[model samples]
Target: MKKKTTADIIENNKISDGIYSLRLKTELSNGILPGQFIGVYTENSSRILPRPISICEADEDKKELRVVYRVSGKGTGDIAAMKAGDKVHILGILGNGYDLECLKDKKNIVIMAGGIGIPPMLGLAKEIAKEFGGDNDKQISAVLGYRNSDTFLMKEFEKYCKVYVATDDGSLGYSGNVIDAMREHKLTPDIIFACGPLPMLRGVKSCAQVADIPAYISLEERMACGVGACLGCVCKTVKKDAHSNVNNARICTDGPVFLAAEVDI
Candidate 1:
């Protein structure tokens, strides 16, 4: 269930040039899962709608929810200006998160994320590490992509899984896209999970299909209402719904996470 509440900003740190990590103290963190998001209200009263930002980390014991976001517009710009001790209205722990249960039987799992899509994968990696334990045979490989060497969360991700990185410029890891890094490393995972731009997701889907491996993808979309009411964030689906008889799905509610083959992308 989603709740409308005011959350106190405990930490607001800049991660890169235009990126920031905002941590909030709230009771809503209890049930938040990897791949879920929070809708943050902007300070600008003119912009009534809240911006949907993906949850980067959730600490249930600490009652803290962290989100990493870029300043792309007025709403996010307002968010970027917020300081510690500030209070903001948020609605969340929303959306259906990644399906971790399905990956349990698979020994080798790959997590591929691009740009800002990299944050949520951290929580997923942590959960997987905790669930499988040190003696388990499961191996997690995380392939992350960035525009340049100025990146965040690399160290955090490294603590949980085997991390590989790719940058458009040769300043960092492999001097190409994540696909190139995966190829160069010869990574062969039994299942794949990805969250990135459309091109990256499409590439991952294609790769999974060729490899005959199951895959899940988290999508990014512009949303008006974070819930399903507004119908602003719908995507084309591969099949018609049994009830609606339409080949459309809501990105905000029906997913932000879906089987790679289920959506048109």
Candidate 2:
């Protein structure tokens, strides 16, 4: 992890009323992998510490990272207030990214992402397409779900592979949740990558467990320090060792990325 000044804010536009995407200039974004996030300081004062926001998009060529966030709380509201030239501090390219090595030579890859969970999947899809010879032999499908069509990021995924959208309000391709869309699509995937609410992730885990397909999931939890020290985002895993029999691993450090079955979810 590294501390860096936010050199520029390219875009602070609203994706929706409560959700906004910020494209900021920062060299810390370079070499970032999928599933890694940045800890951004919402306020200049030390009163409010940095908040972890997932790295939604990164332009290595431009040395910038983009984060999409919802105005659900005060810190985020302040971040939403940021302008094109505002300076901010960030610690980033942190946490364990998805195991890209796992996708090597896979013939079929399927991604199930809901809500903001689709962020990493966007990166994953691009990696998969590029890794497997441009999505020709390796088929890629994204079962993207949102509250409504406007919230879906299918347009981003469409450039990489086929996309199926499922919205609860019946404003998209399929009426129902993402799992329903997955079932309806009847995808026979070699591997599944997913991120979403716990219930949704749990459902994905249970489904993958039964289907005997390997899956990787990105988890969301509150954090104090974006690094390991805080012990704030502890996730219970079955793995146990002598010193730490509790298996209460730090999400900010140990993960943010875990095998589907390893996490309690």
Candidate 3:
């Protein structure tokens, strides 16, 4: 039942190849947590649906929201054209974010992310670090993946967590994927949080199951309606949904983030 609002664009600049950093000033930052996303309505009338992008950071005090996204197609291309001082219509504070309940009584944590899925983890780590209250005993490590040496947000994450990188071309930290980097690093954690492509998430789920570590993951589904009403982004679940009596869940509402064991992956 949320209404769309026009927000002022503070900055819109390309940070890396095919990627952009968009900053917006809006009070809708309230109720938005790490792992939640917003739907940005593009200027083109032909592209009616708003493009949903995971929030990179949200500052309640500044009333600012940071979104880092890839210029994937025409819709996103339109978004890239937007500039500072422009007005954009966005609807959100959407999706149930990463559940912090699984973090209680846990100390060591590992965050796994690949490609554009890496943005949400930055916000997640920031919150985790805050919740830990500067307790140095708590170690938060980020295992990230990239196609090559051109990595984004490396400095921001390095500020909060120990960063390890994996590149497909052997152009960076680890030569293989995130899973290989994790094994090589021999990371032992009490809990995990991940966001990435399906294959990458499947790997993380398997790792969590075999190690008996609690893990939560966000599904990067291509969505039409950013709300559950569309049913365009349902994912398979282990249990039947109470409303539909089917073993499925809408990624938009039920979660873009869920316990590793809760969904089939």
Candidate 4:
């Protein structure tokens, strides 16, 4: 269920260049899932549309949710100016998250994330570890991709699973993209979950198809209304909907998470 509430900014800190981690104390954090997102209202009155950010970590005990976002435009810039103790309107635990039930039987799980896409994978790693007993018992591997070395959340991922990094400029772990790192390291997994740019997701999809591994991908799209009423964030799918009789799916409502084979992208 989604709720519209005012959440207090518990902490808003910059973790790296152009990237920030924002933590909010809200009741909505209780039921948030790994690949779900929250719609945050920014200070820009000129733009009424809320910016949708993926949930990084949800602490039900603390009643808080964390989101790591990049400062891309006016809306996000306005959000970055907010400080601790500040309150903002948030509507969430939105979107369909990853289906972990489908992955329970799969022993080897590979989580691939790129840039800002890395945050959601953190919660996923922790969930997988907790499910299987502990980090040591699970074959969970996190393959992360970044432009350079000044990356955030690497250490956090290390706490839950084996971490492999790939940087574009060779300033970090592996010298190429994450798929290259995985290929070179020969880390084959029974299933894969990925969230990143379209190109990266496409590449991961191709690799997973060739390897015959089940894969899920979280997509990011421009949304005016986070609910289904707007029809603003639709993407072409491989299969048509039974009721709507269309081959398009909404990123905000129908998903943010979809099977790589189902989506056209």
Candidate 5:
């Protein structure tokens, strides 16, 4: 159920080079889950297509949704130029988010994320803390990957999970990738939730498969409609999708979040 709504911008600030964190006051926050995304329309009439951004944080009580994105093109550039009082049209609470119920019985939970993927995990971690209570500190942990020491949302995550870092240039924590960080720290999880670039997801898939741990991943893709109307954001799946009767699943509708076992990516 996607509805087009106008939202007021609370704040739009730079998180780092090329990355911006945006928070909007919207009514569409009721059923939002960890991995869902929204289609944000640009003020420029020339750019009819909206930018599909992952929901970094969804505050149902406050009716606020936070989205962190990298300004890669003209569309996002236009969005970055928006200010506090600006209004934007967005279609949202879209995409199937992470399912946390199934992981409840698991003793240990680990969240793995990289780069912009780190934002959503913050919300997920907070929910995980709420779901598990005081035991969260011991049972949950996060393994985050970054290009360098410049990182955003580190303190926020520390409030919910034990944090570990991995940087490419050895500037922060581990001198390798996230998988390397996990390996070095010997941080094992009964279940894993992850989001990042395709390569990082592949590495997580390999690790999950080898260790026989249940894992879920949030995927990123380019979309035209930002809804299911176009077949633009389809991903390869292991099983046939009942609706389309094919091996492809729409990332916008079917998921941005999916079980690592079900999806090929």
Candidate 6:
């Protein structure tokens, strides 16, 4: 919950057209958790305020953090223009992130992600692999999908766990979506965690339901106040009771991570 302009960009460049990864040297971001995000301002007084980007990887020793983003609009286009030594304003380790505690001790863990949805999964998988030691026989599997092979971040993820990949254009691992790939493998994981576009999540939820396995989904929404005060990121859930104090929970506060069935994303 701190606003710090105390660092310089170490490196920033195109990982692909409209996709870039930046490394920043910042002490304050060392303890960032997976699925948490940073709100960054491209200009000192830009009219659009700050844009929220997912925290991809963190190295406490070097006090380095990485954020991989897509240039979908003006704000992101500006982010793509940043380079080494640039000074930027960042407020973060913001929002509620995924709970690693819930994942501990599970015999089988499966992680599924799509597109830019892949970043947080990378953080999560890295932690899991570190905890269990990088063993090929480990009961961990990661399912990653992209629009095409050109946008894939495969090598970064394969180092830590068993991986399955899907692409819409048939340029990579499987010719269909991730859900299709999952069906092909018929995997029955003890715990499944996912983050992706809403439609993809919906399909994942159904698959998890049919398998009767627990699933967690990290919701990605357009956030105004990364904190909950602005009431800009409310999400509907099935947990609501007629007498429940709050029917909708703020994604910035109550969760960006929620039980798959509870979230209406």
Q: Write the per-residue lDDT of candidate 1 for residues 1-265, one digit (tens) a residue.
A: 8878999999889989899999999989997779999899987889998899999999989999999998888999999999999999998867999877997689988999999899999989988887874846888889999999998899999989999999999789999899879989999989998998899999999999899888899998789998888778988898775446799888888899999888998
> Where is model 5 more than 4 Å wrong at Cα?
136-138
Error of 5 at 37 (Å): 0.9
What's model 2's overall lDDT? Answer: 0.81
Clashing pairs in 3: none
lDDT of each: 0.90, 0.81, 0.90, 0.89, 0.88, 0.80
Q: In what order do the candidates fall by lDDT, top score first?
A: 3, 1, 4, 5, 2, 6
Per-prediction RMSD in angstroms?
Answer: 1.2, 1.8, 1.1, 1.3, 1.3, 2.4
Question: Could you give candidate 4's per-residue lDDT for residues 1-265 as a string of tens digits?
Answer: 7778899999999999999999999999786679999999986789788899999999999999999999999999999999999999998878998878987678788999999899988988888777774644358899999999999999999988889999999998999899999888899888999999889999988998998888999998788899877778988998785546799888998889999988988
lDDT of 3 by residue, 124-150 (tens): 988888887488778889999999999
Worst 10 residues of 1 by lDDT: 236-245
The TM-scores of all predictions, comma-separated, are 0.97, 0.93, 0.97, 0.97, 0.96, 0.92
For model 2, the superposed segments whose C-alpha errors exceed 4 Å read: 44-47, 133-135, 241-245
Instruction: Locate the minimum summed-lDDT window of 10 residues in model 5.
Output: 130-139
lDDT tens string, model 5, 1-265?
A: 7889999999999988888999999998788888888999998999999888888888889999999988889999999999999999998768888887876578788899998888889889988888885764448889999999988888889998889999988999999899889989998888999999889999999899999988899988788887788888889898786778999998888888888888877
Q: What is the lDDT of residue 144 in candidate 2?
A: 91
